[model samples]
Target: MKHSICSFVICLLVCTGSLASAQQANPKYDKKLADSLKADAYGMKMYYLVILKTGANTTENKTTTDSLFKGHMQNIGQLAKQGKLVVAGPMKKNDKNYRGIFILNSASMEEAAALLNTDPAIRHKLLDVEIYGWYGSAALPMYLPYHEKVEKNQ
Candidate 1:
């Protein structure tokens, strides 16, 4: 009798837990926002992921290197404003020779390559790059606006 009573209690608790989880799983879906972001059923989309690496250019000319990097930052800002570059940032010191990364909202590898060529640092070989097709959240582009607000210097 005791074993049967324990089994019944365990079954009741399991059913109650399932009911609570099902209730919390139902969230309000925003179809308009999803459509605007071009999100799939899983709220994801395709993008170009560019990994920046240390280039072979070890020129000692600080002025030339500075100019190239200045142009690089300018190009990054321009692309972000145009909604082409979704995310970009540098990496901490590492052994793998990685320099930085860029997530580009480009339709094809050719388009992404063309965009990278616009950066003087990349064009001059101060920074080499490897690009791959990436599947990520469609709302990744929306973070730029929030980033701007949080940036105190800009």
Candidate 2:
């Protein structure tokens, strides 16, 4: 029984030591990391979250629809390039009125409204937008570069 206890203690120590080593600070955890993470600022910043709902005008003209969609994508790219848009994507499920979402970089509702106005989908009345101010991580601006690196397709 004494021999078994000693062996168990030894095994526990070895496992804990390995675990502690694995939890050590990463080598690249430095001032740059803190700055990149915006750790010095407040925990959250104000942004606008726009929920796109299906508009009243849903008449299907394939060519017009395609053109508007292409223009919508172009507008999204442009907004992202200008840093006005943090993230935007469509919802997969169509059961609800909720269509897609846009996370805008502005704290002002008017600014978000102006940005949404530029989207062809919204302009053409293919999609109606509802904007709400959101408080979220200030680290969101840092996600784009990482997204670009990991994305397999365009």
Clashes within 3 Å, all models in order: 0, 0
Q: How far off is residue 6 in model 2, in Å?
A: 58
Candidate 2 total steric clashes: 0
Name the lDDT of candidate 2: 0.85
Score residue 154 of candidate 1 by CA lDDT. 55
lDDT by residue (tens digit), candidate 1, 1-154:
9999999999999999999886543276678998988888788998999999998888739999999999999999999999999999999999989999999998799999999999999988899999999999999999999998899995
Name model 1 segments beyond 4 Å from true. Answer: 1-27
Per-residue accuracy of model 2 over 66-109 as CA lDDT, tens digit each: 99989999999999998889989999868767789999987489
State how far residue 97 of model 1 sits from its true place (Å): 1.2
lDDT score of residue 30 within candidate 2 = 59
* Candidate 2: 10-residue stretch with minimal lDDT: 35-44
RMSD of each: 6.2, 8.8
Candidate lDDT (C-alpha), each: 0.92, 0.85
Instruction: Give the C-alpha lDDT of model 1.
Output: 0.92
